[model samples]
Target: MVNTFQQHQHAALPRANHDERARQEFTKSLKQFVQQGLLPGLTPVYQTRAAKAFEKEHGKPPADRWDIRKAMVKDLYFQHYAATNRIAQELLWEAVIGSVERQLPELEKAIADLTASNPAPLESDPAFPVPRYVSALDIHCMPGGYASEIDGKDIAQGAIYDRGVYLYAMGYMGPDNDDMGRSVCNYVKRKMPGFQPKRILDMGCTVGHSTVPFKEQFPDAEVIGIDVGGPCVRYAHARSKALGHDVSFMQRSAEDTGFEAGSFDLVVSHILLHETSGQAMPRIFRECHRLLKPGGLMIHADLPPFDLMDPFTQFILDNETYYNNEPFWGAMRDKDQIGMARDAGFPAETIRFDTAPMAIMEFAGADTTYTEDAAEALAEREFTAGEYAPGGGWEVLIAQKAA
Candidate 1:
């Protein structure tokens, strides 16, 4: 008989062409076998109409890496669509262990053979060092978060999450899962799908994951990605140039970007605020206000600070602050980005956009607040949608300035 996880995958079949369906099926089967017959389930939320719509659009055809950013935001958000992430996390380590246990002998022989022949180095040294910040150290359970090189310092992270997924993952660690630092930028691109800004600025764009998608979204726009990390910026720039995307990476602070006033039509960030101290948020908000043109917009895709949701949901979101290395997360959860944007001079009566169409999103409660037990259940079962909607975290909103 077909097993539970494989059964689940088939149950949630993706809407794609015959060949694409075949490929996805093959991929799933390979993953299942490779992981010793384990198949992670889809998120409870994956069954929503919005998710279905996204899957429909995604199933159509493949695009270049540049064009793939359009898919990045939704794909990142798709983490909540299946229960697979939880299993994937556990299985990934298993895969590593299995690779060691089963494939080690062959791997050793291959390594010896390659070393004897003198393998090639990928590239020369970078121009600068990756940045360090008070927030980055404590924000994501990743000390030296954005600065650590995949090859050296930590060794396991950089290549695994970013380069490994490539276009398939929008080259990021998913929403609020900013392993590649792309969360902030991908959120902006997906949220403002219609408006093509002339000049785009990505604040605190850790590794440029958040920055490159804008270039793909608006090929004509002058796109610049800035971050404090020297290594990440250097790596990001090199990656962009190699991929032929016209993007510029710089070393700068989001609190004070040091750009001319009214320089951009869109200024966006992803998962940036929670890491920043409460004192820093106001300044960063003010900076965007000054940099944006009269009709421009400033948007952020961040963890839902207690500001938007209910007491119960608020507490749940707050727990990440304790366990997830996000010291500033609770304060961010409590701060109002909409109110902050309005106060930041985004013009009163701002309009926020929801990426999922109303038909798919079913406009619900005040951030869908729930009880404490529900919240804990949510963290574990968050990837699924239909069942876990009561506990909210992946909140998506876009605030616009008056014309």
Candidate 2:
């Protein structure tokens, strides 16, 4: 077995420095305050205010979550929470970028050596068109988003994302920020014990954190990760190589990957759907269908759908759509994913949706118990209705091609 790249221990990485550590701590504390102090206290008050307003205006309680969200926007508490959250997010990235900028030359030299030690194949196309969904805005308030370069050979965006994501997630993604990939892989193993895929593909595999877990889970599979960002794939290749994994990292769009039809036995994505625009989703789903072999599985792990959660919870989650620069979040969440899969040519009966326990939560001593029978039972059960459980698990959509 190859040695896993323990991100926290990697000396060449940005987080190893004192400045980055302090920035991360500050970001973590800000996030905790927003999540623990502001959100919990403000939600009920906002709901009550919205409820009374709705009754006074329409002679009844708010019709749905959308109405509540609309009303909450006018609430002072909600506005304060939203503004504070945005400031915290922006400040987090500022600190990360500042730290990287301070030692760009040294960090550049360091990554060159780290990536050179065990080089994996990296393919990038200068002629490749950058999608509007990616290029339009600075998603997550990052200065240049994921596809920008400071200079001709800059990897600053990649480095910033790699180091800052853990802090952004407040360590919920574990020390490596790879729980999304690990959780999905674990679900596949328990649900399909006999299914051994020979080839695997991860779409939108930024920095390849999500890509490496597949290699760890199915060591013999030929793994390939593709993204539109050149720096992301480059950093991913270097990270994979440094970690002793032999996965190929390529710069390509998920909506139209250049791979041949039926080339992969399994295709997966982690938190990629919401990042894409509504117009791009159908094409991406079709691409996944076109890429998978007969009977091959395709799974997408992401945030829970809007309908599955209460109005308040939905309102809270929708904050990303407005403040975090993820404009497509609401549109994607409102989508019927299974319906989209069917439109992409998969049979209706083959599509499945279920929530899986997060790998990091499980590893961190949260309830890790999940058997095939238990998964099946959860699949049969309806979506739980109440306050959304934070750090509980992830929602997954699984589809299989016809044999």
Candidate 3:
């Protein structure tokens, strides 16, 4: 069976201009330098300094990550490291947004034409309200966050995210930033070889980077991607179309997708929980439950919970909660996702947590196959103490509703 919907080689649309390309490269390199060179060298010195300071003051080593964070804030080395990383993060989005702003009219026209002619459907509501959590600040310092629009038909937010995320991820998300979905799909195939979903839903699917891969993996399934951001869905629909993947992109809140109950067989979200408010997360989970059919699977891919990480690593990861305007990351990381799922009506015994190796280098003709044992091995890999490895892989929380 030749699947016409099979995705071709990954590619970026509205090709970056020379300046944009240069900026993206610079951002990528800067991020790599910060993560690999600067952070690794400074962490030990900062830790030692912080521990000594804590002992001197409290007659003990730092009792917890909070104590370490408080002491480290006073240390010059930690201060410099945090400041440098934050500045680089801001500059990355600035570069991408600057490039996009310069070509806004052309990019908008291109997206408009592409989406209009594309077979994949796009539905957006002008009346859709941007949640206060999203509107409060520019998450990750991306100007205007994900919902902003300009000139009534703007795709700038999507363009910025699409371009900036590659640099943000430092290529760990594969060529087209679809590794989260691909990794989750691989895990599902290995874990439940006999289970096949007829309908798949991706929530908070920005620009469809994490949405299209499901169509690639389950070519016959009806794949739909939804986000609260209109500009995001608009661009996502166009991007999926451009990539020759069949998908439906809609502007809708995950908490209330307006779909009939039990309408889907699989519901997934990639790195979305951390961006949602504490008050809204349970509702979102409940909505996932409501949307899925009997025996349907709900899978969420995100960073490992703080309980699975060392205190120092937790402190390091929580920096985004304070500095990067991602207010809910700390709360989300502290959440017991299994408990939350159970509260949302999924059976406790049906919930599972695991990790999946990212398909970072696989999409470009590398062998993408995995055995069941290999998947289990990846999931069971012991957590290394004291390292904050975000995007090193995906931590998946999965649940199945009672049949």
Candidate 4:
């Protein structure tokens, strides 16, 4: 299916020229082809041959995702599939990186110009220790790993992520890449009436793609987006301004944010947990519990656990850990998130997993390319293992602090 979704451009975004745009579009199309054309074939390849070969050799069928992985690795089709995905990811970043580098000076100036008049606070600390998990390697094959600064007040890595992630998701994240936050906001509004928060915080908010939606949804609330990446916060501040929101952006780690206790009424994160180390997730959860006031809420949107899916599906999703540079991708799925939340001081009875339907359909006719038909198609499709997002909705882990 042709992806009709398009990103809404702003001053902080890198302007791609004719050739660069073509290369970026090609990478997006290639990724789409891989997900649509190649991914489904894995099931047949495994059930018909790979599993049979493993059973023949081991005297039993493959037991779990690990066994599935071992069996699939020897298959030629799986090799091709994995190779193409890695190549496409590399190409996606390369295409956007070149575009950003070519116009780095111009992009920086645009960010400066846009941020200058914005009233929101943009705080950063040069001495803040970059966690080893983020600083050690380039996560998602990103060239600079989200924290690198090439020059003074550098925001190159953030710029690369801003555009690259759109292509990476194949534009399934809506025009502004705010679907996760928007979905969560919609969930709160519909599920919890009369629960308007006065103060809100978003943790690990890279580039503020998912951060701006909260300000838009709850205009009266004081919204702040925090991240450990300096460049990411800088770019997020500028991007938030360019998008016409006065949300605050700060360089802060969720594991130990210095905010006062009970400073916020609602704390949220989108697709952030799986990227953090095992030791950090629980700390982050505790911090969230501490940051929220009585009767407040903590909501995290991320991948569901391995126990919820079949072994074949688990193996397919685990490809991120092996091929991509996501170190905690697979192991994170095994973590006891509910138990961690309980330990974090959230009441056990208040903790539950729920689906926040994608707000894509709500974006229909909202000025971008999100046509009603296209949004419906995206929201109604079956979620394949390796697809960008689940079809029904994003899986959200939510808990409420004691009142």
Of models 1 and 3, which has the larger lDDT? 3
Q: What lDDT tens digits, residue by residue, belong to model 2 across residues 297-334?
A: 88998877888878778877888988899999887999
Superposed on all Cα atoms, the candidates' RMSDs to the truth, in angstroms, are: 16.7, 6.9, 7.0, 4.5
Residue pairs of candidate 4 with colliding backbone atoms? none
Q: Residues 232-284, candidate 3: write the lDDT tens digits.
A: 99889888877777689999999889999999999999999899888889999
Best by TM-score: 4
Segments of candidate 1 deviating more than 4 angstroms: 1-138, 148-194, 351-397, 401-403
Cα lDDT tens digits, model 4, 1-403, are: 2348567777788989999999999999999989999999999999999999999999999999999999999999999999999999999999999999999888989999988967999998777797989999999998889788755488888999999999998987876777788778888887897999999999999999888889988899999999989999999999989888899999999999999999899999999999999999999999999999999999999999999999999999999999999999999999999999999999999999988877764434233455656655543422222222334588999999999
* lDDT of model 2, residue 253: 94
Off by over 4 Å in 4: 361-390
Best by lDDT: 4
Evaluate all candidate structures by whole-model CA lDDT and list the values in order. 0.48, 0.78, 0.79, 0.88
Scanning candidate 3 in windows of ten residues, the lowest lDDT window is: 1-10
Give the Cα error of residue 167 in candidate 3, in Å: 0.8
Residue 357 local lDDT, model 1: 19
Stretches off by above 4 angstroms in model 3 are 1-12, 361-392
Whole-model lDDT for model 1 versus the true structure? 0.48
Per-residue lDDT value at 60 in model 3: 78
Q: Once all C-alphas are superposed, what RMSD does model 1 give against the true structure?
A: 16.7
